[model samples]
Target: MDAVSERLAEVHGGIARALKDAARTDAAQLVAVSKTFDADAIRPLIAAGQRHFGENRVSEAADKWPALTAETPGIVLHLVGQLQSNKAEAAVRLFDVIHSVDRPSLVTALGKAMVASGRRPDCYIQVNIGAEDQKGGCAIADLPALLAQARDAGLPVIGLMCVPPADVEPAPYFALLAKLARDHALAGLSMGMSSDYPTAVLLGATVVRVGSALFGGRG
Candidate 1:
């Protein structure tokens, strides 16, 4: 197998083991984060049966994915980074799921864009579980209001998403996010990454954003 295929196999193996340990077989989905990587690097993983891929920026995705997806079928694209209100229409057109709907304004924009484009991608409310200044997520106290806005605007919101503080143990944050999703009766939890996905699965993550593990470090 090629390098990317090998890495993908290893990541899939890890996911399987984690699910089996958690008794959560098929409960979670792995979103191979393809941010910063070019299409050449991504094709092998697709050949290896990776269906879900995530990109951070709309412009970069626009540059490659239209042609890529047209050539390859069954590829689900996810927007796993901060989104601008101005780009909502483009995002709705390209992404199957958006994992960074953090505020009421963004929720409104996405709803409007979805209407305009006749596309409603599943959205995940990003919660700043760590409350970090540099991070892009709704404050924990603001999650309810944001979620309400999304629902009122008829957005197809699926669940909650969070990125834990890098220096701290991530389990607590993941657990808290799962609890928040449950409290709101949301069905999806988009949490975890290369370092802590297994822990996330154990803590009830329905979607894990794994980048480095599958594609190596971002270029």
Candidate 2:
């Protein structure tokens, strides 16, 4: 196997081990974060049976994915980034899953966009789990209203997504997200990254967005 395939295998192994420890039979889908990497870098993982991939920018994904998806069918593109309300139409058309539906304005934009395009991508309400000032997630205090508005707007919100405070233990934050999802009756917990995905799986993440671990560090 090539290097990327080897890394993909290792990450899958880690997920498998974590699943066993969590006593959960269902598997957490790995959305390989292919944000900065181009199609040449991503093809190996796709060849290795990876169908789900994530990108941080709508424009970037638009630039790269159309041809790639044309060549290789069954690719699920995830937008795991802060989306601009203005770009909602493009995002709705491009991404298969959106993991950053965080505000009322965005919800409204996405709603209109989905209607115009006839595509309703599954969404995850991003919660600012750490209450950080610089982050893009909706404040925890506003999640219920946001979720209600999203549902009202006809957005198919599947779960919660979060990025914890950078250097601390992420378990607590992951646990909090999982609890919030349960309280809201949301099942998809789109959390975790390269550093702490195993913990995320154990704590109840249905989708893990991993980048560097699979594609190696970006310059």
lDDT tens string, model 2, 2-106?
A: 787899999999999999999999989999999888889888999899999999999999999999999999999999999999999999999999999998999
lDDT of 1 at 55: 93
Summarize candidate 1's per-residue lDDT along 9-85 as a digit string, tens digits.
88778878888898875678989999999999888888888999999999999998998899888899999999999
lDDT of each: 0.91, 0.96
RMSD of each: 1.0, 0.6
TM-score on alpha carbons, each prediction: 0.97, 0.99
RMSD in Å for model 1: 1.0
TM-score of 1: 0.97
Worst 10 residues of 2 by lDDT: 35-44
Best by TM-score: 2
True-structure lDDT of candidate 1: 0.91
